[model samples]
Target: MTFADLALGEPVLKALREIGYETPSAIQAATIPPLLAGRDVVGLAQTGTGKTAAFALPIIDRLDLSQKAPQALVLAPTRELALQVCEAFEKYAGHLKNVHVLPVYGGQGYGVQLSALRRGVHIVVGTPGRIIDHLEKGTLDLSELKYLVLDEADEMLKMGFAEDVETILAETPETKQVALFSATMPAAIRRMSKQYLHDPEEITVKGKTQTSANVPQRYLVVQWQQKMDALTRILEVENFDGMIVFGRTRSITEEIAEKLRARGYSAAAINGDVAQPQREKTVNQLKSGKLDILVATDVAARGLDVERISHVVNYDIPTDSESYVHRIGRTGRAGRSGDAISFVTPRERGLVKMIERATRQEMTQMSLPSVDEVNETRLSRFDDRITAALGDSERIDRFRDIVAHYVRNNDVPEVDVAAALAIVAQGDTPLLLEPDAEPEAPRERRERTDRDRGDRPDRGDRPERRAPREGLATYRIAVGKRHRVEPRQIVGALANEGGLRRDDFGAIQIMPAFSLVELPANLSRETLDRLSDTRISGQLIELRPDAGRPQRRTDGERKPYRDDRGPNRPSFRDGGDRKPRYKRGDG
Candidate 1:
């Protein structure tokens, strides 16, 4: 239905009309009314589904412009998302007098955010870490907060920001209307909703989640650390007129694009932080063939339809299957054949399968091109280029004479002179990387092998090889037998929500009052802190360092993981730039 029919305020309606937003998406249509009435909301939606405007519109309507101590707060996983949400708020609040929306994120100098907060802002959108910083420093106050939104909640959880998010949520007034939106609802996020949302309305939108049949889909299995090298190898040989590399975060997209440009590829970045004029210019450059590659985040690339785009590369696999389809759909439009390639780590094989099912097609597995193969392809292309140059030699008499003069004056062989010219033509990049010049693959991740322990031999019944646990720190969790939690449930929860590969997790010991799980000793203190908030079977986890060895069973029953756990699983964590620094309230 039309946004005008949703009973939005006159100013909001005026802004929407100016922006040309006629109708609302299903999620927005279902969510706005309840939110307007001050009810909590739990919304499930993927990127490009208009979820931003859904929460933005209603929140803007409820914002008390008169009291501007952050009347509404939105927490996003990344800076890109925070800025994107802030932009949506600004666009809709444009017609309203005295309404101020401010975006607070990391890397941006603190002076601007501090100044904006001091003057007062109606709506505040910020990344969890930066918001927590502000809150800790007493620079941000939510006492008057009328609305709280957790956009991309699942992403925050995956990034190990559960504790930071929860801490911010706890500071907001309990009476504040809360709205949570995510592409997927993990158990941790569900538990969070139950704790904070008061009789919240639930909305799930499953829209057209399919890729174009005209696109030839394929995926390359690469180690997480090796994706850059893999991408490099593919680009050296792959034939495409124009391409777009999709990264999960704005920083990463910009970094990748910048690196490509440094290496002489015609590339540019489009992210939420980019000004509208700059973003438009980038799109136009891509359309006009001035830029052959566009590295972009999903949100920034919305409404970017360019027929010149011949290939779509998922440098970072999408968190949701619908996003994958939407990403690849940018290509293969209007009866054109476009190639869609994804770099899938072993840990993310499950997501790959999920995407395949959503698209109703099997993606051909592609091996990463070897450095030698890339060199061979380069040589072949070089030969073809020389042939084509000679074919057009009729009009280049001057260049030929110049080359002849260089050969004679230097007393060099004609082949050597041609080689020198070829080197000049090839620019600063090497014609080929050595076979050994390939970047080292990241240390192989250990996969979790204990998802299904039911089919395994009893610990006392078998003598199997134990998996390696070189640098793991034993952690004691306060949930076990009394909680009715299965080993697989714990494994799945940690693997999916914790963003850890199955192999990254070591032996799991289930006892009566607590359980012991092995995690990397190198895990950051922030990650360890978040572990305390982890829940299994609806029971809170009180995690603490365990210095002692794992308890051995008296019955000679080994833990099922050491005995039955098989090979390591794949690790594909959909794996970010410095903004100008802001002053740290140290919050």
Candidate 2:
């Protein structure tokens, strides 16, 4: 249906016309009318289906730009998504002067956010963790908040932010209008709607049921640390003309892009932080064959119409199914088949299932590439390139003269000269990859093994352990013990941001005010850029190679080593050195 039928104001209509959106998607057509009537809405639609505008346009029409005090609040699951939603608001409200939009999320400096909040804004888009922080500080005054949007609701739930969402909803005005959008309606989400929404109009638009029908979707279940290796292998083996790599965050987009470029792939990153001019330039480069790959977050790649994208790799699995649909949709367009490869960790299997069920497609399970396979792919590509270059050359006579001279001087056969040339072309360090470790046995089998220990030999009879890995690069970040950052946070950010998994990290040491994280020596430059710009605690994480800082002595006057004690132990430290000893220990 036409956007005009949604009851949008003339200004918004003009903006839509300028943007070339003449009609609304199914979800938008169904939900906008009720929402404009001030009714609560529960919208179920796939990603890239104009879900953002469905809620955004209605909210823009309802907002009174004259009174700006965060009248509307939009909650997203990630910083990247929050920024993207904010951009959509800005675009729709361009004709409405004095209307301000602010995006608040973790990893950005609180001072900057605090200043913006104090100055006042018409709408606020934020991540749950950071939104809760602002609410607690009283810096965000939601007392006048008329509209509340939970965009990508299922994603927030999957990211373990459901509790945070509930708390935020409870804090908002009870009289406020609420809208929840998701690709799937899980039991918990439905229960949340019952508790928070009042007589909400439900709208569900079925996604492309067979996600794998025209598009070949596969997943490689590997540890977080090995994702890059898996991606590299897939890129080499798959015959792709152009590709798009989706990361969870803008930092991740930049990180993966940089790493791919370092590995000799022509890649670039496109995200919100990039200016409009630069973003368009990057997209154009990809479309014109100047760049082979575009590493992007979902928001950055939205509305990106490039038919050449033959492959889409999920460097980090999306938070929910809608995001998955939007990501893979970059490829398999214009009646061309596309390939989507997902790197899934064991813990994320549930998410994989959720996506498959939502999209009505089952992703094929694929084996990790063997070192031999990776090497062969590399060699084959190299040979093909060399052969193609040789075909257009008229240097046969020159080469023959040189070969004759070599044969006469060294008493070498013509075949021997050709063999020497092949060796020279092969180059050093011929794309050798280390084999992945075998998957761990099930816990039940391990428990049974323990019970049957009487029939087995002792550990003393086992062979000596192998030497530890070397040639690893250790990097340090400004966050440490004082910031209350945990090893898991670092691991999660690296995996989600840097596109490196648990196995990718060799070692991680979190000290107060700083952390030393080690990754592979051959880590891609894109990953490094991602880590550098990534924010933890709303501060830019300054990551650099660790130059061997002095280790804290266990027996020294430094903070006492908190053992793995029980709940009795305090989680944080005060200024005092009392070092309250836990009777049980910290877990």
Candidate 3:
């Protein structure tokens, strides 16, 4: 049924219609009504299943926007999810006046958030640590909070925020309605839900088999610079009614779509920045053959249904399996055969296995089309044009004679003249792709001069250092939670390339924007430099020797009492409470 059929207010319905959301997703339709009725809910759904809207709509509909001071609170596992939920609230509440949604998280200063809270807000979406920090300082008031949402509760437990989550739960009013959503119901999350949510109504949305069976999936390994050329070659070799190319960001989507159009392909970009009316027109054009491709981001393409989409190309591989499934699901509709192609960089080959496991389907590795194949396809299409014209020979008699007269009069060979004409007709698009080149072997990182945008702020107070080990030395890396860098990735990059055993890797502490790992101390400068060039999460590794001294805390500043657990203590992300995960066998 349409979103209008749900228990939503006029303002929310108006916002939904303007956002181009015509229908409720499986989770949204099931979860919204219970939440609006002031009942606690536990939603079992995977990513990309409209979980944000499911909770956001009902909260906005029932929220007393006039009575500010955070009537609702949402805790997310990551800053990205926190910001995403906050944005959804703003979008859904666009028609409602004086509704303020503030997102509080680390890596951002507190003054702005404190100011916003002082000014009064309706909802606060944040990560556990930052939210706890505010609560301890008495800057955040949850006394009036009528609704409490634990988004991705499993993820929170996985991130070692269970203790903090429990603390926050204890502080909230017992009368507050609780809604907990998790992709997987682990024992911890289940127990917490039972304890926190009062007789919650449970709703489950099965994610497996979500992808269509009629679609055949394949992937090609290529470098980042060669993606455009590879896409062009694949398009030439395949037959598609309409294709949707998915990119990670709005600008990337628009760039790919514009390039395709400039190369004479019918293409348009459907992104969040594009007005809803324009997005609808673009999608309609693809359906009507006015466009052969619609480049889009994940959110922009959500809930889009069309029978004409025969191919879905992952120009950029999705970071998670849920997104990959959602992208490929655009095709294979109406029981029609469809194709899903992914472009994987050599460094990202590991993701293929992850996607396969999630979808429960093997993805065949397809070689990139050769230059010869592209030239052959171009010539075949060129010949088809001439053959089709021959069917209308009578109508083209005058033009055909004009060509013959020019061929006879020109003092050049007929073949040469025809080649020149073909060159003119081919325009700017290259008829052949560049030869494929072998990629270099992976290397370790060295100290970097330039800061990665993902780099987290240094611990204002000195960071804890590991006690001196016999052969292992500590090094700091410039990527952590912000870049989505995990501990295994650090171990995998170094241990795999440096001939070090998994046991050789030592304690890893992941901070907001950086991490500390212990490796062999006696590594030469050359090895350090080589390691610096290694890639993780598509960003080059920026590693340096970790100084053992503690950073000095400002003399006048008041700092929270930190339980200085030893460096070997398991950080939160290692199943949050489990033993050290870097010890080789834990994985």
Top TM-score: which candidate number? 3
Most accurate candidate by lDDT: 3
lDDT of each: 0.75, 0.75, 0.76
Instruction: Give lDDT: candidate 3, residue 572.
Output: 32
TM-score of each: 0.54, 0.56, 0.60
Candidate 1 TM-score, true structure as reference: 0.54
The C-alpha stretches of model 3 lying farther than 4 A from their native spots are: 207-210, 213-215, 220-232, 238-339, 343-357, 362-367, 370-373, 379-421, 425-587
| Residue lDDT tens for model 2, 252-276 | 7888888898888999998757765
Alpha carbon deviation, residue 492, candidate 2 (Å): 8.5
Candidate 1 overall lDDT versus native: 0.75
Sliding window of 10 residues with minimal summed lDDT for model 2: 578-587
Candidate 1 residue-wise lDDT at 44: 92
lDDT of 1 by residue, 248-281 (tens): 7667888898888776689999875677579878
**lDDT for each residue of candidate 3 in 401-432, tens digit (9 for 90 to 100):** 76788877976776787677777877776555
